[model samples]
Target: MTDHVDVLIVGAGLSGIGAAHHIQAALPERTYAILEARDAIGGTWDLFRYPGVRSDSDMHTLGYRFRPWTQAKAIADGPSILRYIRDTATEAGIDRHIRFGHRVVRAEWSSENARWTVEAVHDGKPVHLAASFLYVCSGYYRYDAGHTPHFPGIERFGGTLVHPQHWPADLDYTGKQVVVIGSGATAVTIVPAMADRAAHVTMLQRSPTYIASLPAEDPIANRLRRLVGVRRAYPITRWKNVALSTLIYQLSRRRPQVMKSMIRKGAVQQLPPGYDIDTHFTPRYQPWDQRLCVAPDGDLFTAIRNGRASVVTDHITEFSETGLRLESGAELEADIVITATGLRLLAFGGIQLTVDGRDITPPETMAYKGMMLSGVPNFAFTIGYTNASWTLKADLVSEYVVRLLRHLDTHGYDQCVPTNADPGLTEQPLLDFQAGYVLRSIDEFPKAGSRAPWRLGMSYAHDVLKLRYGRVDDGVLRCQRRPTRDAAIPAES
Candidate 1:
């Protein structure tokens, strides 16, 4: 017999855990199960175990809205964040509802029965699960491998090469010269993180990225928590950070030169005198065109000033036996090369989705409210914001899912599908990000619309009103009643 539930959540990460908590709190009677492909609870936190692995976003906004981050460190390490997520699950007994080692391969939606028949592989055995709704919390990136561009003559290099995603546990780099490729968050994090042990670390980037320095600990947030306690202070601090970040993004977009000058000034103040700020720090694109990389307490700058780390702005010629050859004919010797390139985008955990017998192609479908797809029924997925903290958008998406579920039950409907009836709705890329990883695979993802409900809301303040307080039956999402069959919605997984 196939297992069944009211909702089947396809991940155990922060989004999935938060989604579960909202469902349990709002609709106590509804049954749900979280199917985790990995053996652990913390999804991205668990998968990423490389040294110096930490969140780019601050803990206050990255942490769940319901849970206050009690730790002093605002820019938290990976293990700490993992502990927070696992602890959240354990405290709520959400751990009991997770089915680990279950990798969902495909999902078949049946309109006749108003259910989704999920196919998964668990311990080399096939397992079938039926649910009224499918919630995909599996993140947008390929967990197996990060994006690694082919370096010419890489095979000729005698030194050890490693990707940040699959960092070897026993790989030694003591007193060894290390060269990290790419100027994204991972590259910045790895440079200072490995600088202390390595002889020297060089960050080689094709072009500079917008990097901003933030304090490792937020003194204001800590002070507020101490004075008023976590319950009262969390939301206040959360909103404060949200507003500040939005204002900065707006300023960057509005007055690009002013923002550029300010950022350049900050880099100049932190770096050594006569440093090439224009060549090594300044980015060609406007800030927020790609994600702004964060360097906590100016750690990366400190590393550079101390001569433990350095940045090289140039194109790669090829990999040499000793090190990498630059287009400028300068050769940097390295004992180890770590490719901190980027991630490969994966949609719906790379699961094949079919509506009845017909296949659902993501490129053809349009995103409705940044959560549900326009032609898909009883489905939702979480894709976080590029501008601000990921959890801010994640929390909003989770709350909105609860609202969708409530509407289905309260109105005596089995399914709901968002249909694009507006002829004027112009299709745009789902994510406007220009990162190499995004640009490489954006065509595989769904499209966003030109207007409301169909447009992607990158702003948190706007999403709060639209998602949290917006009307559910807006005539676009058609909730329909099906012939009531013997619905076998189980109470638990």
Candidate 2:
């Protein structure tokens, strides 16, 4: 099947939906197609289904500016969030434009035609699409497959193995001992939820992660949302939430002892051992250096404090039938094992782009405000940070992309590529923090220069100011004539 559109959007998640909304609203006449890999929509939100999965970031910044979340819960669970994505897509009429089963295998740029030839598979059938511009909203990496350590006897274990990403909805764990591996957010979320029904839950971690337990719902904020629309109320709500979060984060940084004390209280309540608190509750790094996992209503910590769950801070030696063997020769038996390892990050499908047959290595290319790749014409990607909600950055990037598209259309120009080639330029990591995802995919992902049009800013206010209202003629973007063949669609497949 051969389809032609002015724009091709991959991934029907928050960013892709936002991009479609902007395009449909600003340029209704322009034709576009959204190609999603999954059979259904909602990228990451739809993918993860661990026991107590919810947003760590508040809904104010997590939601789109165009669409405000009216729910009373500031921190919502997975189902509600997925519904919100679906509702937004439907409300904006973006759902109908999506090709749900389409997965893009590879996309190659044709300099002669000044267009991208996107090749994808739709329901076991080949589909070809060509677009004047390509907007990639596919998320940073593969869905969390719950990193399973290669325990020596894992294959022989009698218990069921589960990764948070592929959790079975109907799997019963009640009255069964469960061992959850890894101290990441997914593992933390699963421990408490499983503790409610399981006979016992044990959390195993090599090193502790900084965890903050807070209320599930904010009373005053919920009231404000109910009284005023999300758009009008969001400012106060976001600022208030961010301010409090920032304060706690600062306290955890400046006074780890205080934070540590608070954590001990929460942990000892559930588990009666004084030594256990030091083992699983104490992290190696300062708070907020990595992401701080949030358990709404303090459920995870509360469960620990009440003796419903136990934490073991030790490396695993290997798997044993009906249980796990620790490095200290200790065996913990469980009916089910959940691996909450982390996700593997991939940048642009690890695709190597050659503009005019020149390799456009991501690290060598400048990221124009973390959206538009410098030297690539009419292309943008949606990337968020560990600090803020993914959509906050994505919404701004979507708007900027639409703005750039409109500017090109109005000026009667096409083929907008950044050709500023400085061979002597050095590349560096966008964020200073040491995150596995960022570090692993840094080379594959486009590099952000230390200055404007190359630097990646995680701040929402700064991005809004730059991407929303920044002048088009910033001397970084080079817009020129659309090749004569660009208007002509590729030959039918």
Candidate 3:
């Protein structure tokens, strides 16, 4: 017999745990279960074991709104994040409801029964479960493997190659010359981290990315916490960070050259007087064309200034026997090569979905309110903002979902779906970011219309007003009751 639940949430990550908390708080009567593919909690945090792994966004904003981050450091490491997630689950008694090692393969929704029959693999066996509503919080990327671009003659390199996503626990890099490929967040993080122990570390990139140096501990937040306590300090700090991030993003979009100059100037100040900032620190593209890389306390620049690390802005033509041969005919010799490439985005954790025996492809549908998809019934997915802290959008999404569920319960509706009514509406890519990972997978994801309710506003302020306080019965979202046998039957025939 298939176990029935009011809601079935996929993934036990930061989003899933937060979703559970919201559901338990708002719709206490509805029973739900979280299915985690991994053997433990903390989806991304637990999965990524790379050195110097930490949140790019500060804890004040990254942390859930319901919970206050009591840590002194705004930029928290992976283990600390994992502990925070685990502790939240433990305190909320959400840990008991999570079924680890359960990987959902397919979800079939039947309008007749108004339920989703979810099939998953657990402990090398097939398990079936049914739910009234399905929530996808599995995150946006493939966890099994990261996107590692093939290099010419990569096999000829006689050195240890590592991807930050799958960093080996037992591997030793002490006194070794390390070459890290790609200039994204991972490369910047690993360069400074490995530089501390390695003989030397080099960050090799085809082009440059805008790098920002921020204090690990936020002084304003620290002062506020001491004065007003953590509970009050959190929201204040979160809003301040949100406004600052929004202002920067807005400036970058509106005045690209001005923002670009500002970012370059910041990077230049951190480097040595005669350092080639134009060649190494300056990016070809404007600031925020791709997400800016943040190095807490100018760590990456500090390492480079102290001669422990270096930056090479050049393309890799091919891999040499010892290391890489650049397009400029320069050779980089290294004992270990870390490929901090990027992630391959996966929609709905690659779980196949069907609506009453009809296959449903995410790319074919349009996003509704950035939470639910068009033509999808009783289903919602949490996708965070690219411009700001992910949890800021995540928390709003969770709150909106709870509000939606409660509306259904109050109205006695079995299903609610956002159908695209306007044929004239122009479709756009869900994300506007030009990051490599986003560009690689944008076609595979859903589209958003040019108008509101159909379009995704990447602003937290906009989302809060629309998602949190907006009416649930807004004309586009159609709610209906399940058809019963009696209702389908003719009175007299």
Ranking by lDDT: 1, 3, 2
Q: Give the root-mean-square deviation of each candidate in angstroms.
A: 3.2, 4.3, 2.5
Q: List model 2 lDDT by residue over 1-493, tens digit each.
A: 2377889998998788888998898899988889988877888889887777888887877887787778888788888889999998998889989988887877777667778877788778877788889988897786534334466878989889887879898889989999998887788888998899999899988899877677778787778867986677877887676567556666767897787777667656545555556667777776667787877887877777777887888888888888888988888998999887767777765445556656677766777777777767778888886666788788888888888888887777766766455565566676655555455556666666656666788666677889899987676677766556445643210
Q: What is the lDDT of candidate 2?
A: 0.77
Stretches > 4 Å off in candidate 1: 484-493
Cα lDDT computed for each candidate against the true fold: 0.92, 0.77, 0.91
The sequence of per-residue lDDT tens digits that candidate 1 reaches over residues 1-493 is 2289999999999899998988888888989999999999999999887779999998999999999999999999999999999999999988999999999999999988989999999999989999999999998998888898889999999999999999999989999999999899999999999999999999999999989898999999999999999999999999999989999999989998888888888899999999999899999999888988999999999999999999999999999999999999999999999999999999989999999799999999999999999888999999999999989998999899999898887877888999999998899999988888999999999999989889889999999999999999898898877545424642110
**Cα shift from native, residue 144, model 3 (Å):** 0.5
Ten contiguous residues minimizing lDDT sum, candidate 3: 484-493
Residue 14, candidate 1: Cα error in Å is 1.3
Q: Which residue pairs does candidate 2 place in steric collision?
A: 269-305, 269-306, 270-304, 270-305, 270-306, 270-307, 375-418, 377-416, 449-454
Least accurate 10 contiguous residues by lDDT in model 1: 484-493
Kindly indicate the candidate among 2 and 3 with the higher TM-score. 3
- Top lDDT model: 1
lDDT per residue (tens digit) for residues 164-281 in model 3 = 8898999899999899999999898889999999999999998888999989999999999999998899999999999999999999999999888887777888898889988888
